[model samples]
Target: MTNVIFTVGNDMRADDGAGPFLAALLEADPAAGWEVIDGGASPENHTHRIRALSPKRVVIVDAADMGLAPGEVRRIDEDCVARHFLITTHAIPLNFLIDSLRETVPEIVFLGIQPREIVFMAPMTDDVRRGVAALHRTLVDGVGIDSFPGIAE
Candidate 1:
């Protein structure tokens, strides 16, 4: 079964760039099997492409304000996504995108990384960078998301 990763964020923004940064790393890795889509600030625009891929699983990565320390990562449950993602830069609600994808994608996971800053054109904070790098390593190593640091419920 095919698995796809949809990264949502604006690279121009500081920590909000986590998604895209992770996307770049995954794309360059020759051993990575999942398709990576850097949705940038408008992941809704890529809905058609994701549907076309017909992936069995779709993982959405984004910078979220989960009230946690900077660089913390968590698997945000669908029902709790809106609660944690308050400062969104996307054009539409992520929950909406998830709802739309549910029709075609059997499984959807939202990976949220707590961001320290999201200023426009600012460099990503070290904390968030480390979080993104950890996530990248987890993906490239084919490790379960549950094994990632700060992933506990």
Candidate 2:
């Protein structure tokens, strides 16, 4: 099974950029099997790209407004994501896309990093940066990708 992950967010927006930054970090790691996509705060634009890959496991990383304490990272399922975050684009809502696709695709999951602020033209806040780092550690050192097969080494 092909393992794929998509990072969608606007790097210009403080905490919102966490997604793209994490994507960059994952891309830099050769052992992490993922497709880094700069969704730029909108996932709609990348729907086609995802369709082309047709991965078995699809993980969408983004900054969400779950109303939790800022910088909190949560791995939300499809049912909860829409209620928490608007899920603007990132290729036609993974659930909807999956329904539309006749061919069997991959399992889709969402990992949302709570963003303190999504304001324009600002760098990442310290809390958001720390959050991403901590979250990455979970997926890397903790889960170790090895347990996930294609996701790690």
Tell me, by lDDT, which candidate is best. Answer: 1
Best TM-score goes to which candidate? 1
Write the residue-wise lDDT of candidate 1 on 29-64 in tens digits: 722668888888999999899999999999899998
Tens digit of per-residue lDDT, candidate 2, span 80-152: 6665574353445544543443254557766777777777788899988988777666665637433321210
lDDT of 1: 0.86
Lowest-sum lDDT 10-residue window in model 2:
144-153
After superposing candidate 2 on the true structure, give the runs of residues whose Cα lies further than 4 Å from its correct spot.
87-104, 142-153
In model 1, the worst 10-residue window by lDDT is: 144-153
